[model samples]
Target: MKKLACTLIFILLSCHLFAQDETHPFTIRGLIYDEKTNERLEGAVVSSGDNASAMSDKTGFFQLRLDRKAEKLKVKLVGYEEKNLVIDFDDESEVKLIIRLTPEPILLQGVTVTGEHFTEEPVVNSYSIHPGDLSKVPQFIEADAFRAFQALPGVTTAADMSSQISVRGGNYDETLVFLDGIPVYNPYHLVGVFSMFNSDILQNERLYMSNYPVSYGGALSSVLELNSKQGNNERIKGSAALGLASAKIALDGPLWGGNFLISGRRTYFDFLTRMIMGIRFPYYFYDLYSKYVYPLSKNNLLTVSAFYSRDALGLDDDKVFVAQKEIPNWGNLFLNFSDEYFLKEKSSVELKAFMSRASLGVNTQVFFTDYYHQMGTTDTTTVNNYIEDFTARLTFNSHPDGQALAVGLEAKREAIHYDWNIDETDLNGMYIHPLESLFFDFAPSQYSYSGDEFYLNAFVTDKVTISPVSELTAGLRGSYIKNLKTFLLLPSFSFSYNFLPNLQVHLSYGRYFQNTYSLKERKTEAVFTPFMATFFPEDKENIPYSDHYASGLVLSDIFSEKTSLEVEGYFKDRNNLA
Candidate 1:
């Protein structure tokens, strides 16, 4: 029996060895550089996808293997950025890269690539934001990815805090952000003045306003997908930049004896907050990000990613009627790893695991007519809101013959905690606080507790070309909320009719939902009422909100496919918010 067991173990070990790698004819080579400074970046981490990795010496150069029928090769590092390459591994290949970094960006995930989808490309209600579009926007000199969405048809930015974005008139929390395959909640800061994400580290930002794939949900209005550069297999690279709030740096290259790449970034805003705010208050924040990828084999790739950020705001008010100091604390963290396995020339599978968490806290103490902390009025109040989402997902992508199909299953769990005081209100409809104090940190809270929620979902979609001139896209998605024991089904489809090769009429519609937000609902949720750093619970008993969405588009080939005019209109609705 012992001999037989040893034989079986030997067989399994042999199989594992065979699955590791396949040596082929060609080798891959490349160079890496700084995207902003246009200088060679040395010590950049570069890897094919797994095991093998090499850092750029003094020259930012790299080299890796290319097995026949090979899959994806990625390169990553710290201080600059990462780059990814998808190639047919039969012959030798060479590529160059420019890594970008700006101050302290929050977190960076993988890039999502799309250009020509046979489904006639939703001509009307959609717009594509490419790496170049980021440069064309006047304010984009800062490379704030989410802000660019505001210029599109259905997008808007929170007027005061520039970072928060709303799609098709939807609420700020209705939107969703995806980094690589992981989810990011509240991807901005200080009423949205700065995007929590750094553009220099990202390769592309795709904003889905009215039309989005079923692979994502839990947000009501739209989806913003950010793609990071895959680590370079050919060489190491890096970059750095300075911004209004902070400074940052990054690097990407190979590992695993030259088969993997690692990348990272860190910001210092706490070091810069000395800047004054008209003597009313002082503000500051900071963050760090890192990613790594390994090429297990030509057909299989592995990756890991992580991020962290923290922000603080302090305000003081001293007048004839009020004396108060308001302080808010916020931050986020995320970690994820994914595997891309190819089954055939046209079919592939992706397995991923990730964890994300965020928190927003406002601690204050008010004063009374006697300048003493009031009982109910001046009582110390603390509103601490935190959200943590852990997820695991599996996806299958196939483009067989004329059929485009994708299927996936995902599970996400969330936890939220809010603690604060709702002072009395006046006739003008505002919470009237009775007192104010110094050295604010919630003035010390009395009662505190937390809440938790979870969700499980499955989705699938397909695009089939019936003929030339016309095509169809159909998809279905459903999510089950473990906390609410509720399930929501979303079905989507789009049609495009081309009267002329350069002219096509398109129509589309879909249902959407989003989780991971403050749940702050007020009477008038417009661009005017800025974030006040207080906790206001929306009347869920009166208005329950779970999801939000929009639908509609236009496509015209006024010029070549490279440059065309597109016009789109959309509408959205939501229920239950605070």
Candidate 2:
């Protein structure tokens, strides 16, 4: 019996040894993706030690046979990420894995808004500014987007020399300005000294000094795009401050447990100005902005934006002789609304609508004056003008890699009907739209005129990798421009060369055109001065402009581009409506 027990134990040990030798040939496989985006990686390699290795596919997938003796695996990828996997291949069973890569943290130092939209992809002729760096620049005050702009190369000294702000030799008229998708004809509120935007609430200010993509056209010289804060989805926050011309307060936070972003900003400078200036009456200026964003579902966002501004330069009440009676009644109004909608990510499409009005009227207190001007003969000039624009547009946004892109499209229409009626004419008083004078001789005492314009434009840009040292971007744009009644095309191209890891070289070329022109050409320095609206006998005389722009930016991570001492130059030529 004892002998039988010993033999049975020996048999059991033999069986165990044989089982160990038959170790199951297990295989482990996984796909790699960006942590935040869940985007798959391409061309990644997973090697155990050169001999024991496997390469990952474009989808970041790799399969390696497990050896009972092998223990660890090493992974590497160019320009992206590298990592090591700890595994014990001693088991005979199959192992599945989802490998993760750690992204390299990079400190940015360049133009403020230019680089924020697409960091992964190579953008042509764009400056990327980080708020962290902007906060440290000494020459510019905080929140002064334009001030930061003045520090870049390619910026002309003309405006600075003339004590003005002109970017890339572009006249103030030639620059296109926008804030939170709202077209801002005038970016300044306090005589060019202060921008209308609140820096504290400002998220980014992108400047296309030249060679902007097909997605952005219509402006001749430059494009200054201001992005307001989208509000924190994770927290509620607000700020209030008093400046020289105004005092403002802003509030933003999450709604419904952090699914929605709501924010609002308002300024009561006139009230503060009146208090500080020791004025008997209120001589003030004020502006307000509000925005709400909600994610209806994954990959979809809905946003509502609003703005309001009023400038009361000064007010006066007077009595004038009208034939046989003394009449007294006077007030002026400056009001505006800017709103937009953004849908889709990177392929973002927007519907934009806005209205602006500046009115001055005088007449008897009891008359047909419900937002209407008075017509009389007592040295009184009534100027009333209304402008409305609606645009649906698409924007082309790309990341450092072509794998992600942001594109948008839009349609736009605008109407202008402004009038100038003269009562106490200087007999020879002359008032004309700056452009009208260039085309026709006119007087400030003219009647009202009207104009209607429409535009439709679409743009798409993609980020593509050329090689380890270079990135390429290709973009296309199509447009339906009215008033001239035609379709136009704007194409743009740009590339960046990381000549050295620390130094980046950029080049961009683009075609840009303008379908509309501003009536207020750049002459009025004072607010109370008379405003002259130019008239056109026919809209056909107003010719559309065609322009071409090229630019380059040299960026560095070791130094801030603004203060890094860059040297840039550009050349532009165009024909004015002569």
Candidate 3:
């Protein structure tokens, strides 16, 4: 009888302990997703109040075991808002959760738009400035992007009449400009007095004065990166402005479950003069820009961008003094298509295809009399310049182990055509150069060239935080130009250290290469007519390149809020100038 009672008591005690264990599992399971796209998000970390944490797998699934006293859980991921939840321990059951996080980009330096206006934010880089603040500065005819650049350090304008900028004592052609992720061979309008970009459409602009990243090549001096705003996904908005020289309008709205934006600008001096005064002003320019964004799926997004600009000048043959008719026209056109895909493993991939073309044409007709007023002659000249490029690029970006890694490949096919012909009589020369060459007459001049070349470029960059007070960025770029059959390896490095809470130091070094060079032509009356020239190997050894070294010191909050003082110096070594 005693043995039976003992066995029963032991079994009852064991059952009670097992029941208590089953009641409090202390385990939580979850699946994370993107709030906007409804796509699974991997690499997210889920942590409890007890400091127990687990990372989501490729399937966005995670399981965590928490302390019995833990009542709160949190989830965190880069480029996403943090999510928190409260646990119900009273339920006494395993907790399963489906958490969604909103996407948020981490910007090192940029502006924040509140309502319809943007607020200027202090940037760590002294060269970085908010594009919206450009309007507050004084304007020459209109708010010009290049003019704003001139206000920055190490940048200078060629003249009051020109908007082109020279950086670090480098020529304008050495600087590169990028709009919406594509290179713009020429980004000027209205005789180089205005930038082609419309300020209303610009979201941000960043200038790298020296030792820029290696992801960009084909420039020896500096880089200007401009990004246009995406359309309003929730509502329709429009803005219009009329200045003394030009009129611009922008419209953005939702379309077909996507978003679209279109902006345009045109100089109206010629139009107004023709309409009000009934006179031929003979000069005008117009520019158009458009972009479209669509989410093809939860993990894929598509975007399209297009730009066109033209400047035209015309003169009649019945002019009073010169009796010469001259027609000059130049324009740029580009189209870009891009796709971004979100992948597992805390990474994303972007693919882009772009087509660009620039065209220049000038035709002249002159009817003149000799200096002695005895002979009459007519001379005609025609010139054409064209550059066309097709480019394909693939880029992969990832955040792994607290470091940012970027790798990309680009292939471009460039074609160029240049031709000129002059038809003139012997008297044409005597009429113009009577004192110097009255007895000698000039012969007809003609030249033509048409060629195409392929280029391949690849780059990789890694940004790492060395310590709490220091960071490092290093990259390398390799480029191969088919015509020259030469390869170039460019490397760049940047390091930043915080000497104090309010003081910092920066050091950078970079090597850059350029395959295209700009040639400013003086054949026309226009002040500036720049044409692009590509490499044609004679000896296959003359490739232009430059090395840049720079250092800067910044002191923040010296006097007031959002105020800082910075001093920087740079040196550039250019080689093989053509």
Per-structure clash totals for the candidates? 97, 34, 0
lDDT of 1 by residue, 347-456 (tens): 55789999987776665654433345342334344556666788898877654434566777787776665455544422112221221111112222233446666667
Residue 517, model 2: lDDT of 57
What is the Å distance of residue 283 in model 1 from its true position? 2.5
lDDT per residue for candidate 2 within 1-578, as digits (tens), equals 23433543453344334333333254556656544334345546676643445555422445554455345677775434668777764544655577766655444444453323333333454465433345554433334566666666656433332212456666555667677656754444433444555566565567777777566667767777776655655456566776544456777767763322233333465455568985434244455666666555433345666655544433232322223122211122222232223221112223434443333232222122223355433344444554555565434232211233435556677666766544433211222233123212343445666887777666656666688788877676667666666666677777778778656677666676665554553433322122223332244445445455554555444344322323455667655442
Candidate 3: tens digits of C-alpha lDDT, residues 411-518 = 989887877665645422432422111111221256577888788888778788798788889887878777777777788888889889878898888898776654
TM-score of 1: 0.66
Worst 10 residues of 2 by lDDT: 324-333
Of candidate 3, the 10-residue stretch with the lowest lDDT total is: 434-443
lDDT value, candidate 1, whole model: 0.56
RMSD of each: 11.2, 16.4, 14.1
Which stretches in model 2 have alpha-carbon errors above 4 Å? 1-123, 132-143, 154-164, 257-278, 317-378, 394-408, 422-443, 518-542, 549-565
Error of 1 at 35 (Å): 14
- TM-score quality measure for candidate 3: 0.75
Q: What are the Cα lDDT values of the candidates?
A: 0.56, 0.50, 0.70
